[model samples]
Target: MKFEIIQPGSYAMIKATLTQGEAIKAESGAMVAMHPNLDVEGKVDGGMFGALKRAVLTGESLFFQTLKANRGAGEVFIAPAVPGDVTILELNGANHFFLQKQSFLASDDAIAIEAVSQGFFKGLLSGEGMFIQKATGKGSLAISSFGSIYKISLAPGQQYIVDNSHLVAWAGTVTYDVQKASSGWFSSVTSGEGLVCKVNGPGDVWFQSRNPGAFGSWIRQFIPSKG
Candidate 1:
């Protein structure tokens, strides 16, 4: 199977080419187009219990769309729910990644996505909730962001501060803690940063240029009140 990202920046989409019997799995409703020869099915990847956990804990769909070129070679087009950038990461079975909710787009059939707990405080303060999406196994995983995605490479023991809302995904080797953006809560709120993650690495972290939360707030200002 081969994956190509089209329209790289905003409004990005993925075009995946698969050989006979090869398959790819994507987030529900991600399919934009596909060849007639390809077959698509909805599957509860890790079974009913796992699906329920993913849905209840992480806010992901209960089922995934599995597309296969069973009859012959074919291509499928997949896109994210919102306008943004898309990126692909190749996993070799030796590493895994943790993704923010709704960041997952698609991945090879071999990749496995699950909802993993990131602890109560970390999840609550990080703005990613208590359960985060974890991708594992060997395959290509596609992730989407609300805006352009930026990669930050951190050396061992190096630390960086990131606004909680800007996080996309991070390598398994990276660790982070939720903290106030400034020394005091009032200052933090006044600074417009509020909570931030102090990420420590020996790994890479991906962040979106735009914050969906901030964008939603901006949009709300223009919406007329019902009263």
Candidate 2:
């Protein structure tokens, strides 16, 4: 299968192309525009404001959207994200085809994972887990990041401990566990590996440029909170 990313690091539309019989997994609802002939489906749980929240928060231009094609090809996926902040992911096989970066959040009114997962049948299983959207065989995807992306790959018999503050994304097949750092929080905090997210086996891992909670602290210092 062949894939390409047309635009890098822009809030504007990003495009990709894919070949048949290939697969890509991502967070759903990243499409801003595409071919009219393509078959599409958007899945999300049936609940009060569940679908609406995804449309508003996840940075998806639309609520729980998808596209499919049996014989048609050469489709385009656009990022309809707001001008300042965008969240989208485009993948082809195990590689990232495209990504857009947006600024950090200024408030705690974050989007819920379960609402975003509604775009796919999987719906968010955990209140704190990440959301996923995937494509099987021949398609391009677009994603957004708050800053530049980082990568880590794990080998067989090896394990990785990543701070949730730095984690961006990882391969679908890999397993993740929240564990105590080998050298303790002090070591990790000082060494940039604090209280880790342990990952195993041949797959990629991503890390964010900054932490929201950490950022929040910085924001709070300027303005005291009420008890």
Candidate 3:
């Protein structure tokens, strides 16, 4: 698949062209436009139960739509529901990623999507929730982010702290933990900063320039609550 990221930052979209017999699987309803001759089929991504677990745990679509250029060649336009940026990454053998829930937009059929349990403390306090999305295998994966995406390639024993709201994904090759943003409880409360993620690596970490949760909080004040 060939891809071009249009509208690079906020309100981003992807324009992809596929060769004959090539296929891409995307979150259901991710298609904004496509060629008339393309074959688009909706099917359970992993398996019926696997799809259910991913939906219930990670908030991803239960079914994925496979787009194929069966007739000859085709093109598709894809965009996430959020007004954010999108990135297409190529995965190598067994190169897995621990992605924020619902960050995945599309990928080649070679990718395997699963729900990963983040455990109790990290799950509840971290912005990523208890169960997160994991993508494995070798293929091209498209990920969407709240704003611009930033990357940090870590050296051995390099550690970085990030506000959970700003994180998009990290290599499974890194070791990480989620904890309070401040050293003390009082500071954590007064700072208005919530839990954070600490990643130690020889791999890479990706972050978003904006925080959707913080943006929501600001917008929520103006939104009238239900009676």
Candidate 4:
């Protein structure tokens, strides 16, 4: 299977070419176009218990759509739910990363997506909820973000501060500490910088330029809401 990331930011698409019998598991409603020869089916990823874990903990829907090239070679197109950039990650031995909520787009069958708890403070104050998606096994995976994504590399004992809302994914080799952005609580609220994450990295961290939560809050003033 071969894949191309069409467009880089704002709006991106994943265009994949699959040889016979190649299959890709994708998020529901993400498929934009596909070849007729490919067979499409909806699946509850993992089993019943595993599906429950993903849905309840990770904020991801239990269902996923599978596209299988049953006939000859075929093409498939998939896009994210929002306007953003798309990133393709090749998974091999020792591949494991902390996936941001709702960021997973697609992957090969060999990959496993699970909801793993990240403990109390990270669960409560990290902007991301309790359980983040943990991707493992061997396969290719695609992730999406609401804005341009940047990769920050870290050496042992080095530290980086990231706004909680801007974090997308990170390598598991790193350690993270969450705290208020400012030492003074009054300054924290007034400065428009809230909680931030102190990532003690020996690995990489992927962050987004835009904060969707803050964007929605800013635009909601003009949009009508239920009383």
Best by TM-score: 1
Displacement of the residue 23 alpha carbon in candidate 2, Å: 15
- Reference-based lDDT, residue 37, model 3: 66
| Cα RMSD of predicted structure 2 | 9.4
Q: Relative to the unseen true structure, what is the C-alpha lDDT of residue 66 in candidate 4, on a scale of 0 to 100?
A: 91
Compared with the true structure, all predictions reach lDDT values of 0.93, 0.43, 0.86, 0.87
- TM-score comparison, 1 vs 4, better candidate: 1
TM-score, each model? 0.97, 0.49, 0.95, 0.95
lDDT of 3 by residue, 1-227 (tens): 88788888888998889999989998899999999769889989889999999999887778999999999898999999888889877789868898889688888887998999988988876787789888899878889998888889999899999887687888888877887789997897788875788989978888898888888988999988898
Residue 225's lDDT within candidate 3 is 82
Tens digits of per-residue lDDT for model 1 on 74-191?
A: 9999999999999998898999999997899999998988999999889778987889999999999999999999999999999999999789999999999999999999999999
Clashing residue pairs in candidate 3 are: none
lDDT of 3 at 134: 87
Instruction: State residue 206's C-alpha deviation in candidate 3, in Å.
Output: 0.9
- Put the candidates in lDDT order, highest first: 1, 4, 3, 2
Worst 10 residues of 3 by lDDT: 188-197
Clashes of 1: 0
TM-score of candidate 3 against the unseen true structure: 0.95
Model 1 stretches with alpha carbons more than 4 Å out: none
Enumerate clash totals for all models, in the order shown: 0, 14, 0, 0
